[model samples]
Target: MEFPCDDNRISIVDLPEDCLLAIFRKLESDTDRNSFGLTCHRWLQIQNFGRQSLQFYCSLTIPNLSPLSQVVPNINSFHLYRLLSRFQQLSSLSLSGCTELPDSGLNPLQYFGSNLQSLYLDCCFGITDNGLSLVATGCPSLTSISLYRCSITDVGLEILVKACKALKDVNLSYCSLISDIGIRALSRECHEIQAVKISFCRNIFGIGFKGCSQALTFLEADSCKLDPEGILGVVSGGGLEYLNVSALSSCIRGDGLAAIGAGFAMRLRILNLRMCRSVSDESVVAIAKGCPALHEWNLALCHEVKLSGWEAVGFNCHNLEILHVNRCRNLCDRGFQALRDGCNRLSVLYMHRCCCVTVTAIELFKYIRGNVKIKEEELMYIGPKWPFFR
Candidate 1:
């Protein structure tokens, strides 16, 4: 037996500095980043020199100032402030799901003025209009902003929207403070806006969107207190390309969704009607007949729909690519078979918690991406398995 010392030898000295920096930047977990930072002097040097985007879940146990910390420690604050100053290259920032951080901790974006672009503060309990103002004023060039479940008021949104003129994509879903006034301002000021998601923001019912000429590519105002009048108003505005209003939690079952199906069906590309228990199979059929351009649809958690609803969607929407029917116990294998039979361009399918659907549904739906998954009955209903995210 000959010992092959040459074959076992590995060297980091030959690797380029840029290549090493790229490796450090690719690290997803902050713990891993900190570990790599401790490996060697060479690694530390590369980490400091490299420009990297940081996404923190905000826990006090994470060594540095957690995103949950309402009052950022002086040392960590100084460190983050210094990092942003030295590396003006930081662009993407997501502080979502950290319920602990208070308003003070989130206001530091003013220190990062003009550097941040993509910001996701979804489900952050500490966030309010004041914290939002800091980001909008500091990051004037911000294009993408998602603030779902934040306690952002209309006043805060108004100020922030005025500051962010170049905004193209925004998601204010479940921001209950927003009213028709905020929507009206967005319609008036944000002319370049392409996508606006205000799901369950039930304030924009009777209020009108004045600027309808700019051609908005997407609008998701699902489950707001909408009627045929509100639906007609949005469609008449002349900018919608994608519309989602599956569940209104308030008035989803009435003629609002039907008005959407009949009025704006020509321009829509995607629609989400998840958990709209009020919506019956008749509404789905009407929408399918009206919205000829609709391609992607989500009917998750809707118990009212039956085979007739699935048949209409399958028959009319030939370009459908993505479909979500999670928790819809009414849809059986027959509906899955119909989806498989008609939808040729389908790529993503989510049928989580649909008891009527078995593993057979997953096998039938073609073109599913690697990201999509199907949970078993016991696991899906009882609790999540390991490596699965809720």
Candidate 2:
């Protein structure tokens, strides 16, 4: 037999292990990684070792825990404690929508708390205050947690903030039971908190945000009963980057918006004022002048703002990229033209339900290289479907 010693005949297996690992790292999607892993045993081992985050979504079809236990031996009896104990290297764990998971399932987490950095328990209705208390006490090193639509109340939140002082981000959105008490506790205890989402938590008011940590950057309180006082309290923190006070028609007015424009001038990047009927041209102009860093802005259904205000925004906020003027009956072609002229960086424009915006002005927007989603009715008259229109 003749031995082939040509360089062109070198197989992929001949490459160094570190080189193969580096190649695998370049694969972006899980499907690509999995396919690469099946090529060889060494690749499979590297892929398995690279997998550090685990997520489990139990279905009613597999109601019995026996089959799941066979697949993931550590998750026997739906006990999270046993699972965490086995996967000591896990940095992130998500048990979202696990309604069957009980309080006892979290008891063993204390042993592996230091290893955990992020946890998601969204819509886990079966886990009550007692279960949440166990999580707070156990996960001392946790930096982020999401309890969206959970049954956790003020008592559970108090326990969590007290224990997880290192927490940076939290999401209590749609948690109906969370009130001012819980918000106050979180603000006072978690001084390092950066982002919070409390939208649809009806009981939360402006007072809940008072004296919040200066480190606070993002806040979402849409569809809540937040008043001007609450809005003032949030802006007073000064480090805010993104703020959503949408649908607070009864509370937010010219004064509140002016306060936001003044306080968040340097840091504010995104602002959502959807359906804030009280917002007028004066306040809009004030916001444009004050917030130079403002990029993405939503003024949908704010009918009080006219062409003059938008013109000012275009001139002042050069960095503005996204603008939503849906249902703003007062805005006309002249205003949009001014806006287009001033805001050279405008990328996404929503002009649905604005009857005053003529087809000529819409055609003018076609020249700009960005997305411009108009109402279906408006598209019919425009003839050719542009690639940018959606």
Candidate 3:
């Protein structure tokens, strides 16, 4: 049987090498590119050279990663650290959920030490302080490190800060073992540290930001054991732009909020006080009075915040765009009206589970110039299910 072929047809191979590469670059998706590359040897070579980031999901066997590394030699962003020597230009690596990646597997990363900058080992349960110590020693150029739910402790953190002086952003969220010692070490050593997230670290207390980097702009210590002193230490740092002190119900009070508002008046933009039950109108008033640059405020589950506080925020924070007052049971129609009257720039308002808030109250937000979007939950029924039966 004769195969159908047009005599005048110009095949893709007939095109110039550069033109072929340009065509491959426009493929958009990696899968499509890979498929196109597999069509011919030249396309494959072009794809390999042009490839910048590569992700291998559960495909890499811990014992032997040579085959995969040999497959993608020019990858800069990698998931597996097994044969990093092959990829000298590697800059970002994420070993998230790589349960098989043990301490010994991290040895390969030493080859790309100087080149690697962003490292994420989130939820890598096997990675302990020892493994991280190796990481610190190897990846000295690391600027961003996220170890969410990792087994790393203050010891590992100390080692990391001691070695990685260029470190700017670090996330130790859910690192339960981390405490004041580790945080203090970071503050003392890493002067370039801009953002530190220690949320859900229950053991952390008294993380004094007094001596820390003045470059520190973002701090997230939600659900931590930070007291008033700790809170003051953070706000007093004078460079904070984004602060999330949510769920510090026991330690944070009106005074602490006021201090934050006053200290970070011009810089403060995003403030999250979720589940901070102790915070009342007094604290909100203080924030409104001080933080003129406030844009996003999350007072979710803060039961104490009433109409007065909402009004204060709306009236004071002119730049406020997103406001989350979810579960603020005290918020009513008057509060919504106040918010509408004060916050002209308000665009997104979340009032989920706000039992006292009526539809009539929410209607007032309709007149907002930019068209305000209000997210609310079903009206909560506080009375007995069967009044007659009761």
Among all candidates shown, the one with the greatest TM-score? 3
Q: Which stretches of candidate 1 lie over 4 Å from their true place?
A: 1-49, 59-80, 97-102, 106-108, 204-215, 218-223, 233-242, 250-254, 280-286, 298-390
| Model 3 alpha-carbon miss at residue 322, Å | 1.8
lDDT of 3 at 69: 54
Tens-digit lDDT track for model 2 on 51-158?
557678544224557654634223333466556655566778787757667777787776776668888877677778998888887789888888888888899999
* Best candidate, lDDT: 2
| Per-residue lDDT of model 1, residues 1-390, tens digit only | 987698687677557888888888798887887777577777777766565455664442245664555442332344546666665656776666566555666545676657677877777767898887777768887877888899998788888879997777778889988887887777777778777777778776735554443557667776677665666666655556666665565644544466666655477766767667778887888887887776667777878788988877777777777677778878888887777676666666666777886775667553443343433232111111211011
Residue by residue across 220-304, what tens digits does model 3's lDDT show?
A: 7878878766776787667777888878847666656666765454688788888888887887888888888888888888788
List runs of model 3 lying over 4 Å from the truth. 1-54, 59-82, 358-360, 364-370, 377-390
Ranking by TM-score: 3, 2, 1
Off by over 4 Å in 2: 1-51, 59-78, 253-255, 363-390
Displacement of residue 32 (Cα, Å) in model 1 is: 11
Q: Lowest lDDT 10-mer window, candidate 3?
A: 381-390
- List the lowest-lDDT window of 10 residues for candidate 2: 380-389
Error of 1 at 28 (Å): 11
- Give lDDT per model, in order: 0.68, 0.76, 0.74
Provide the clash count, candidate 3: 0
Q: Could you tell me every candidate's TM-score relative to the true structure?
A: 0.63, 0.76, 0.77
